[model samples]
Target: MTNPPEKTPENPWGPQNSSPEQPFGQQPVQGQPAADPYGQPQYGQPQQPAADPYGQPQYGQPQQPAADPYGQPQYGQPAAQDPNAMANPYAQQGNGQPGYGQMAYGPTPALTSWIKRVGSHLIDWAPITIINRITDPMIGGYDYASKTERVGTNPTLGFILLVVGFAWFIWNMVFKDGKTGVSLGRQVLGIQLVNADTGQPVGAGKAFLRQIAHILDTISCLIGYLFPLWDSRRQTFADKICNTLVIDTK
Candidate 1:
C-alpha cells in the first residue's frame, strides 16, 4: 500500500482556498461590502467633516455682520431728510408767526389792529356814502314825507350816480386792491390785504369772491366784521373764508 496520505482537518464553513492577493482565508461574498480593518471610509461613501485650514467661519460657528445693502446711516449718525416731503402746515416759526404752510417768498407780515381795519373800511366807503346823500332827493323819499313834496325828482341823475359808485367800488376794492395788495384806503392807513398763507396779493377773482362772502357778516348782524376783536387771527368771516389777512405794511 502506498504511504498513507497525511491526515488534514477540513474547514467547517467551506473548503479552504486562499491566495497571496487575498490575505484573508476566504474571498467575500459577491455584492457584499468588504470589512475595513482601519475604520477608513469606503469608496462611494460621503466624507467626514475636516478642520478649516484658512481660518474662515465654519458651520455652527459665530459670523460677522454684513454691510447694509441700502447704505443707510449707521449708529450715532444723523438721519438724512427726504427732499420730496411735504411741509407741516401748523409748524411754528422762529419769528412767532404760526405757519399756514410753506411760503416761497418770506415770513408773513404782522397783523393789523381791529381799529385800523375798521378805519380803513370807513375810508373806502366814504365816497359812496357821500354820493348816496347827494342823490337822496332824486330817489323815492321816506313814507313820512309831505304829499306836496314830490319824491324822486331826477331819477336819471340818481341812476347815473348809482352806476358810478358801483363801478368805483369794484375798481378800487377788487381790481386795485387785489393786484397791489392795497386799496386807496389801505394805502392811506398803512395796511394791506394779502393771502394769509403766502404773504402775497390775492388776485381779482378772489377779491370779488371775498366781497360776496361779506354777505355772511351782514346776515350775522355784523358780528362777523367784529370777529377780529376776539378772534386769534384777527380775521373776519370774509377774511377767514377767503384765506386773507389785513396786515400792517408800515
Candidate 2:
C-alpha cells in the first residue's frame, strides 16, 4: 500500500479541515454556528413571537370582559324593566268626567205659543157646541133661533147633554192624549201635551188631573187662560199645578 499523506501542523484532522473552497458536505467547526440548510434562523436570536393578531395578555393582569354589541343584559344579569303593566287610553280619567257621546244632564223642551193654544181650545169646543145646538129640539122641545137663547131651556135635557159632552171631553183628553199626546184640536193645531219633567207623553191619569185643575184656572176670571202670553215656559195656572207642558208637535 502507498503511504498516506502526512498530517499538517495547521490541521489537526488532516484532509478533513473544512475550508471555504470545499464548503459542501462539510462538518461544522467546534464553538461556531452551523450553516442553515433551509434558510431558517440560527440559534441566539429568538424569532420575535409571531406578531399577535389579537392583543397580547399582560402577565399578572386581570382580563377585561367583552363588550355587548346589542346592549342586552349579560347572560346571568337581571333585566332593566318589568315585563307586565301595559298601558290603556280610554279608561276613566280624573274626577269621573263623562265619556264620549254621553250626556251629563237631561234635555229641555220647547214650549207652545199662546195663539196656538187658544186656537186649539176653540176648535175643540166648537164641535161640542154645534152638536148641542143641533140635538136641542129632540131632547128638550125648546126652539130658539139663536144659540144664546138655547141655554137653560129644559134643564133635564140640558143636564143630560152636558153629562154626555163632559164624558166625551174626558175620553178625548185622557185616553187619546195619553196614547198620542194629542187631541183632535191639538193635533189640528200641530201641538202635543207632555209631562213637564220627563218630556214624554202625559198618561191618562195625569191628563185627568190636568183637566180637573182647569176648573181652578177658569175660576180665576180667565186669567189662567191668558197667563201663557208672558210665561217663560208657556205654562198657565193649570199647567203649573199638573206638571204638564203643551209643545208644538211640528
Candidate 3:
C-alpha cells in the first residue's frame, strides 16, 4: 500500500536519529572547570589572592607570597623563624601564676606576718638552737649585768658594742653564703638569698652589689622592708636591682 507510506529505517543512524530529549554540543558537567587547580571555586566576583603551600599560584589566580590579611604564618615558613615570635605575646609573664616555664608559684604564708614579727622580737634565742654547746663563753654563763651599763656606767661599753657590731655586720656580709648572706636579721628570719636566674647562692660580687644598695634600704631605717608587700614579685628595690630573691628556709 504505496511502500507503507515511505517508512523510516529500522536502524538509528543520523542527526534525525538523535533523541530530542537532550540538546547537542553541550559538555557533560564533569568536563567543565567548576573548581580552580587548588580545589576552590573561581567565584563570580573578582577572586582575592590565596597562598599555596609551595609558594606558587595556580593559573588565573593572584599570588599572595608573604602573608595573609590576618598576618599569620604564610605558605611555607615556620612562625618561630623570627626570634621575636618566641617572645611572650602577652605582657603578664612571671606574674605568680603558671608561666610557660617550670617556675612554680612563690613562697606562701606559713604564719601571719604579725606572728613572725612578734616572734622576731625574741630572735636572739636562735643562736642557741644552732649549736648545742656554746661557741661564745658569755652566752652560756649568765652573769646578768656587767660593771658598765649603758645608762649609768661607761660610755665606752656602748661605743665598743656599736663599733664591733657594725664591723661584724660589714665583714660577714662581705663574705658569707646563705640566706643571711646579706644580714643577720634576714638569717634569723629563716631566709636565704638566691640568684634570680639560678635561684642558688650568689657570690660575693653580687652580694656586694646588694650591700651597696642596702644604703638606700637602711637610709630610711628599713622602711624598704615593707616594699615586698606592694611589689609584684615580693621584692624590695635592692632585691630587684641585684637580681635576687629571698626564699624561706623553713
Stretches > 4 Å off in candidate 1: 1-107, 141-150
Clashes of 3: 2
lDDT (tens digit, per residue) of candidate 1 on 1-250:
7998897878766665543344456776656667578666778878665556765667876874455678676677776776888877778877977678654456557899999998999999999999898777887566555655557989899989988999999999999999998988899999999998777899899999999999999899999998999998999999999999999989
Preferred candidate (TM-score higher): 1 or 2: 1
Winner on lDDT between 1 and 3 is 1
> Which residue pairs clash in candidate 2?
none
Over the stretch 69-88, how does candidate 2's per-residue lDDT look in tens digits?
A: 77677778775664675544
Candidate 2's TM-score reads 0.49
Tens digit per residue, CA lDDT, model 3, 1-250: 5655677767343243334343444333543454455756555657665666777777886755755666578657776455555666444566646555555556652322433432442453244343323222323334357743233244455455445655554456656643334345545676566777776677877787876786776687876666766666666677888887766667
Looking at model 3, the pairs that clash are: 179-192, 179-193
Candidate 3 versus truth, CA RMSD in Å, comes to: 15.4
- In terms of TM-score, which candidate is strongest? 1
